[model samples]
Target chain A: MSDVATRLDVLKTYKLYVGGKFPRSESGRVYEVTDAKGEWLANAPLGTRKDTRDAVLAARAAVKGWAGTTAYNRGQVLYRVAEMLQGRREQFAAEVAVSEGIGPKKAAALVDAAIDRWVWYAGWTDKVAQIAGGANPVAGPYFNLSTPEPTGVVGIVAPQAGYGHSLLGLVSVIAPAIATGNTVVVAAAADAPLPALSLGEVLATSDVPGGVVNIISGRTADIAPTLASHQDVNALDLTGAIASDGPGAAPALEAAAADTLKRVVRPELDPFAQDWTNAPGTDRLLSFLETKTVWHPMGI
Target chain B: MSTVAANAPGVAGSGLQDVAASEASLRRFLHGLPGVDQVGLEARAATLGTRSIKTTAKAYAIDLAISMIDLTTLEGADTVGKVRALCAKGRTPDPTDPTTPRVAAICVYPDMVATAKDALRGTDIQVASVATAFPAGRAALPVKLADTADAVAAGADEIDMVIDRGAFLSGRYLDVFNEIVAVKEACKRPDGTSAHLKVIFETGELQTYDNVRRVSWLAMLAGADFIKTSTGKVAVNATPPVTLLMLEAVRDFRAQTGVQVGVKPAGGIKTTKDAMKYLVMVNETLGDDWLTPHWFRFGASSLLNDLLMQRQKLTTGRYSGPDYVTVD
Candidate 1:
């Protein structure tokens, strides 16, 4: 064997995903990521409130076209994400094993389950309106129909810590938000942000439009307040906050979100301990949606 | 016509005098004015826009911006009722609070000039009109001249005239210069008082920053009292860098000729934050001299309500919604 190794692996530089492009945080700050053994993994961009603001701008700009897309077309695009994630299964599995201190078989299973979760939500995209909306029986000579529409931009606090959950939790929160036609600004898990950042790359190559999914990797405490209080953000998901900042953080964020009357989704259990492989309920799908009832006179 | 001689004291021999005399001189004058570094200008404007004006200064800027607005209605569907409503809004922007200072002027189409003047009668608020085949400037010289004459005859305190973009782009510099001079003469009333002439470059069509700077000097040299950025009708109207270039031109013109010309950046400036950024640029670039409504104005329609909402927030310490403000 040679005394000196000739080759070295080129590690990826994780960046914030905004407006469909991967850019370094505007503050030029980064945090160290490590494996379960405490070895240095990579430096992830420490996003700031400005990054959250830029993400909100991008999300708001994307609302009109993304919401106007046919449900069938949205489903096809989401399925395309699954197809791309499946191609990168090995890379994600390896990362998950190292980050979560799991064996290869468990990592593989986790990656498979995450991909299948995407496919499940992909199928739900077309059927959500049918399940959540219906005709409202009203008195008098009128026909009324209640249809669900996107509530504009939604801010997501993805569950951090632990490899399998970090990746799957992000997919769980984000797919439902966007599948229902709302654009999302996701604050990915802080310690285990590599998988989420890599997913941003997958999203870019997939058919998803820019600005539809803006992912920021940073401390949940630092980014969540800005996302919650932002006047333009229409909704928020507090999954990652409950995981990273303890249960007390969610209500503070929820109270701050009340300033703008944001539609908030609070977690029922510890986000880090949830079994992401199980079938997700329809509550996530109904979180970011608003129902609009249309009335028409029979004589018309 | 004699106003050109009166205004051309220090401006002469600086190439502003003989711009229309020869094509070579006009080319030399325009080309001789410093070349614009696009990247540097945009960076400087973006950096200035980051300055945070809070609390007391925010209130001051909001009010200053409100006072500088030229409440305008130039749509094809504008009617006498619309003009009257705009006039009332201009007179008292916030009816609940009489402390709100009235706007500087009310701008409208030339045919509505008389209605605007009648509605704004017995007040210091000026009735400005867009004239000289405004927004396009594609008419014959006689028709353009008559357009200005008609607005002036209808008691328009100010005439906002569009430069012939076709002539300016094709290097007919003298035609553009003389057209401005003719409009300046047409702004003069029979009673020996001339309405202040504002020359609009329609800078969106005049693509290059170099063109914007050159035309600024051209309009000022030809006896224009104010040099406006756009007609508020283009895809890109009144960007910060374009307005910054005009502010620089006015500063330089004042330094050379000892004549101060006002700068108005019209269109796309819709929010209080946007107006505050422009005011910050003006404050830093030209100092407090241009901060007054006499030297700076925003030709906007919807900007008033936003300014009012922000002002209410400043006074009440709570955010106000759109429903509280009246719809024009």
Candidate 2:
């Protein structure tokens, strides 16, 4: 009845991304996400272990087609992601500022860095194979050359700390895994999942195929173990597990990964304290690749 | 229900009573059958597929699934050596583990039946051969019958024949029915012993769930020992919903007539998990009667390796890799 007319803000219901579609967790459970000041942001899907398995299935199904595509086409698809991300820069910066308790200027800078990271990896899609593979000198009369192939589906534990770290860390993990044709099932940052979930939107709008990049927003502990022990997952990144609770956290995941002999990438330093702005090296790009050495007999 | 019995051959002493006296009667009978609610059927299948079979149940299901495989190799490039290797795999899926049960049968093309028969000698494993021009049943009637006769003469225990889908889609139901009866008759050897006749509908070409249901009944009525879902050559092969619908047809057909018909969902079923889902569906839908190898079979080649790997996992108490199992 007051003279002042105030409108209600329409908040988003954050959901998980699987096979290029946004769907609620199959368990139908959600958790409240709050900003730096403990103010209600949104209710994010509390993805269960089953959700992790489903995401892996989708990623595995996508591996053949995504890897079979020409490297030039892959580069074009990745660049499309950067274009989409640039278009949504304002929304991402605002969300990063609220999630990390940072000022607007700092959040904008972080968003710009994350956008530029996608373009950087986009250019590397067609070049990684050439750099990682080459001819080998053999003892016999034969032509031996090693070519890098994708190691199938990869499971990633995205960085789960603050604002800039969440977005930048996600870009760091996903770009390398996919730039070389491997698909990914990522467990997004539990605390600041908004940026990662928004990135799923960008990926879907880009030429990135369905099931190439699946994002699940939930507790890292609840989801990481299933991905670690899954028989079909070819590799796992334990970047977020280093910052997780309990003394046996990272080691237990590594042990589970050993059941499948998955190629495990352990963070070299404390994940939360690392400087994400520094230029990433080829170590991450080489993590999810397998080298196949071809031999041909030298004909007379 | 009584109407199906009146037309079905070898049922109620009808001796191939014509189900479709006229085109109108054929349409009436097909339309009279229950309409399939596609959404509900798919939902039911997906719900059953989510049942988490673990530990003892998973172990048991894996073995049962292995035993039910009609280990198949139907490629144009198949040779005697390939059939021999396939028969060896069927007899002993996992050579390292003697506990592995031999498969139900070894399915091959008609010309390879002699090799499979020779390789499976002195074993209870049956040899199944695809006849009726196999993947495409486009030949003349005489040639199709001769194809079935050759496989049966070569000691095939079962003959899988494809229906002329071109005829079935063009409203010639009677022609389709007569072709199945002809194939069934051709399965008889000179000594009066006959190979079991399995009719393949190739559901992917049938185009609709309602068509699947109609063809299931038609194949059963024409005296099919087993109603198969596909020839494994189409884009959309045996899916869970289609298999579930076929299971319903067999269940209902058996209810009306005293005779029992089997179901085989062939093609695209590769993993142990997928085999388990089909087993779960059979268990819940048709009950325990259809759980045996005689009543249900998976026409697959790669599915056997996955089942063996899972079986090794159960016995070894640890996950087994592909290197541990033989690849034939």
What are the per-candidate TM-scores when only chain A is compared? 0.94, 0.96
Q: Estimate, for each residue in A119-190, the C-alpha lDDT of model 2 and write its tens digit.
A: 989898889878999998999999999999999889998876533677877899999999999999999988
Q: How many Å off is the CA of A248 in candidate 1?
A: 8.1
- Candidate 1 Cα errors over 4 Å, as ranges: A1-5, A161-163, A243-248, B1-4, B7-107, B112-127, B152-155, B168-174, B189-193, B204-214, B232-245, B267-285, B298-328
- Name the Cα RMSD for model 1: 4.6
Candidate 1 clashing pairs, residues 3+ apart or interchain? none
**Candidate 2 iRMS, in Å?**
4.2
lDDT at B298 for candidate 1? Answer: 97
Where's the lowest-lDDT run of ten residues in candidate 2 chain B? B1-10
Off by over 4 Å in 2: A2-6, A64-76, A123-150, A243-248, A291-300, B1-59, B92-101, B164-179, B190-192, B202-222, B234-257, B267-285, B301-328
- DockQ of candidate 2 is 0.12
Q: State candidate 2's TM-score.
A: 0.82
* Candidate 1 C-alpha lDDT tens digits along A17-99: 89999999999999998888899989999998778877877887888889999999999999999999999999988887776
